[model samples]
Target: MERLINLNSKKSLTNEQRQAIYQRLLQESSNGKLRKGSISDIANSYAVCTKTISRIWGRGKLHVNEESMVDVSLKKSKSVGRKKKQINLGEVKGLPFHRRSNICSIANSIGVSKSTLHRRVQEGALRTHTNAVKPDLTEANKMARLEFCFSKINRSLSNNDSTFDDMFNVVHIDEKWFYLTKSSRRYYLVPGEDEPLRTCKSKKFITKFMFLAAVARPRFDASGNEIFSGKIGIFPFTTLEPAKRSSKNRVAGTLETKPILSVTKEVTRTWLIEKVLPAIRAKWPQGHTGPIFIQQDNAKPHININDSRFLEEASRDGFDIRLCFQPPNSPDLNVLDLGFFRAIQSLQEQESLGTIDELISAVQVSFERMGSRELNNVFLTLQMCMKEILKVRGGNNYQTPHIGKGKLERQGNLPLQIDIDENLINEVGSYLGL
Candidate 1:
């Protein structure tokens, strides 16, 4: 017989306790006796706090019966048929602009139609164009960029006898979104998966905040211990403006709710004057000032790029920080942007946050919960990207060598090297290397 404990809250059970209950259930079944207590009774007794035991007990074996197995097979067949219909609908609509593949192509791939694909895209699905054309890179500009790249590489080699790491001291900086919902609610486990599993809704649209952060290679102290020190800058997605425009014509008219615009350059100017400058002075009272290198992307009129408030403050304080923009349209280079956004989406969905204040709090909590290990993963991704660039820009060893140096180097060599890495290469490989 087992005794139940009163739960202070609706907190879920830990894995160990659940496992214990499973052991106890097995013992009861093997004995062929009426269990002293019900599954929930045993769960509460062992402090598992889950109704899963009761569910498993009532459901008996999970193995499907013959009739039910056939039913499920038929259901899947019907689902496939419905999917075909949906794909036909998409082919009709997409006929005007896009050249969609046949229904067989769609079904065999994911059993999804063009309409479903479009809806998923509209819903912010991470879909990619399989046959998208490469962006045009003129020969001249390509040559220049190649020369610059080689110059940088040579300068790196000349500066020190450092390995590949020396050539790429890239610090990727970007913002990410995080929601306030509990992580459990945000992510779902398909069951029987590996540890450290991720939740799905982490990529979904949720009310989340942006975090500006910079991830550098993990450093080590003089004692040979690794120090995972990275910079974290907070940018809460809360509104300052209370009044929001309801309609196009009502920009200056009646408002629905006061809207707090994002912390753009304008907001940073005000924030620095009021809160940031004083905080900086108070934190570094020794008056430390020097040139700081910051890597960031081009956000909507970034303060570091357009506004002089931060620069002026840094200058006044004797700290000259240069904010270098990452390559255009390259979010993969910005680790924090990816991490922060995932965090934002996860927390917001988990907490099911309603109000703006609640959302901000959730984002703050999510960032705090995120540790340096996760940050290191982001940095590693950036390193891999640099390695890939070096590989493609290499001489003859690369798979699809991007001939010439940079944009400028391409001027004299193009038309010849223009379609060097064209889509037709795999389709028609002339130089069949073993």
Candidate 2:
């Protein structure tokens, strides 16, 4: 007889345990002169109810072997329980477009609960995406983008399989307006902690400063140590003037800095000559003695390439630098616009600033705090975007490609240049009538 265990315990018996009990009962019955209460006696010894033993014996009798022992199936039948509810995806999709905007609305239309629709979303039957307005590209813009990408290909080594040139000689410059603070901010706090309060005269009239940022591709030696970080500088569009009247914060004749709200051709030219050139001259890698291209967007306020003052200053200091314009309506082609500006903006927004000086300092510090590897990755992304543009025949309708940069960098397999498909290049060239 088996040892007696707790019958009131919540734990259920396994199939093997139940089978052993049945076999023992059958063996006892075979010994002859079975008692009238033999089933109850066995159930009491096994710590199971009499009804459970009776059911097991009933199932055992249905599948008796040659030796008169039960050999019943352990697994339950598939058709024994209730079936799962089925959802008609076609009916759900056929609902009005506005009605299918959210789970609650869609579920109500389909006569299902929101939780069921949420489960489908979790299972990838539905996806959530944020749409933004993309620039409308004309035929000329598309062809220009294609030509720009083609110019970056390094075909001197091998014409069959061309690769992109290392963009160390190219500097990406752009202007971005950094605001004092966002209207809405999110924060995490302890249960009993007080919420942070911030105020502004008007959200629409928040203090903002426009800054011009310039960056080049970082250089590394054979040992993988960065020799030149390629951070030229970030200059703010602000000017200082003395206070003409007494105020609570300051007295008359006190020098106060104010942002230059309107940027013009003259302002752009002045900063490029005074601030941008000097910084590039100071930070330019000594080993690299080649012409540098300062790439900018086709903004009207930007200085023209043929500006005599810029050309004159650019040719000085033993540096061959020139200004070039990227394709219009294509912000993805610029490294700064691709991701660097947003990275620095996120860091800058973390600081508290009450004055223009503090804002400028915060932005400059954030720009310097950014890692060179991140900037390098943005440059790589620019190349990948170029490849995508070529693939789509210069149409910006494709998603950005993720090449697992982190994993590749960890394995020391991160490539300096991405190779362009020869067939793609030829096909794009033929399509462009080049």
Q: Which candidate is the best by lDDT?
A: 2
Query: Residue-wise lDDT of candidate 2 within 1-434, one digit each (tens)?
Result: 33234445434457887888777767767533345787878777667767677777767766653456565434565476666456788998799777877899989898988888898888878777665678999999998999999888887456776888889899999999999888999999999999999999999899999999999999888777999898999999999899999999999999999899999999999999999999999999897776899999999999889899999999997889999999999999998989999999999998988888899999999999999988888888999999999998888998978898888888988889988888887888798787
Q: Locate the minimum summed-lDDT window of 10 residues in model 2.
A: 1-10
Candidate 1 lDDT score at position 2? 26
List runs of model 2 lying over 4 Å from the truth: 1-86, 91-101, 156-160
Instruction: Write down the worst ten-residue block by lDDT for model 1.
Output: 413-422
lDDT of each: 0.45, 0.86
lDDT of each residue in 1-108, candidate 1, tens digit only: 222333443545555654465556667764434366666567666554445566444333332232232111111233443342233444445453343454334434
What is the lDDT for 45 in model 2? 68
Cα error, candidate 2, residue 424 (Å): 0.4
The regions of model 1 sitting more than 4 angstroms off are 1-218, 222-228, 237-259, 262-264, 271-290, 304-308, 338-340, 343-349, 394-434
